[model samples]
Target chain A: NAGVTQTPKFRVLKTGQSMTLLCAQDMNHEYMYWYRQDPGMGLRLIHYSVGEGTTAKGEVPDGYNVSRLKKQNFLLGLESAAPSQTSVYFCASSYLTPSGGRQVEQFFGPGTRLTVL
Target chain B: GIQVEQSPPDLILQEGANSTLRCNFSDSVNNLQWFHQNPWGQLINLFYIPSGTKQNGRLSATTVATERYSLLYISSSQTTDSGVYFCAVGDYNQGGKLIFGQGTELSVKP
Candidate 1:
């Protein structure tokens, strides 16, 4: 089964251009997250959704927006992309169970590499 | 906000050697996980140890929740094990959002 998949594995955008990255998960998880990975910065959260129709701001949400219109799909939008926004983006999902002790392990998609010129 | 820090920033090991990586976080956490980002850039989940200890094959991890630190032990390292390891914490107050550490880049030479 395809656990998590991201669309547009690679993209090149000119400054001020708009684009969207799509993430789809078949795990039927309730939590989905969007993160950007920069050299030496690890992975910083961009935005996240607890479930369909719910979204929240993350550590780095200034230049990005997100929508969880469907339960299995999470979308990240860059309205006016800049060179500084260029980074590898990742989408992850996890199943939150009622049990307390076990940590919810997140399943990540391959990643989307964006280059802004 | 809770902050996460990973030690050694970078490490180099010869094949079949052993190494350890450390992660420290400020404040309490509900959950924590370890991920290995391969050279191809795929983030693979390695462990989900919020506390206590766990082992799998040549890898093992220990989390001292009370001390706010975690350690990952890699035994018999191979060239294929070269990658960046990241520690992420999940806070209940943050709706289970994960805060990631800077990561420790590992290079295993043949």
Candidate 2:
């Protein structure tokens, strides 16, 4: 099963250009997240969705937007990209077991590398 | 807000040696995980130890929830074990969002 798959494995964009990265999960998870990783830094959350049609801002959500139009798809949009926005992006999906404890073991995508010049 | 921190920003080990990586977090958390990002850049989940101890093969993890720290023990290290290890945490208030530590870059030499 393709747990999680991200579109456009690699891309290069000039400053101010816009693009969208697509993430799809076949695990039927109820939650999806978007994170960016810079050199020597941890992955920081940009946005996430608890379920279809619901989205929330994350630790680093200033320059990005997200939409979850379908349960299986989450999209990250860079309206006006900047050099600082160039980073490796990851998408993950998981579920909080109904039983208890709220344990989460996320499944991650391969990642999308974007270079802005 | 919660914050996660990992120690020994980098580590180098000879084949067959053993090592331990630590992760400390501020504030309480409902979920905690250890992930290994291979040289190929794929993030692989290693452990989901929010609390207690779990062992698998040459790897074992222990989480002392009360102390807000976790430890990942790698025994008999091999060259193939070289990678960046990350610790991520999640709280109930964040709607399933996770905070990740800077990571510990490990290099195993033969």
**Shift of residue B93 alpha carbon in model 2, Å:** 3.7
lDDT for every model?
A: 0.92, 0.93
Q: Which candidate number would show the highest TM-score if scored against the true structure?
A: 2
TM match of model 2 to true structure: 0.97
Shift of residue B37 alpha carbon in model 2, Å: 0.7
lDDT of 1 at A86: 90
True contacts kept of 1: 0.72
Residues B1-110, model 1: lDDT tens digits:
88999999999999999999999999998789999999999999999899999999999999999999999999999999999999999875566789999999999999
Listed in order, the DockQ scores are 0.68, 0.77
In model 2, which runs have C-alpha deviations exceeding 4 angstroms? A99-103
Clashing pairs in 1: none
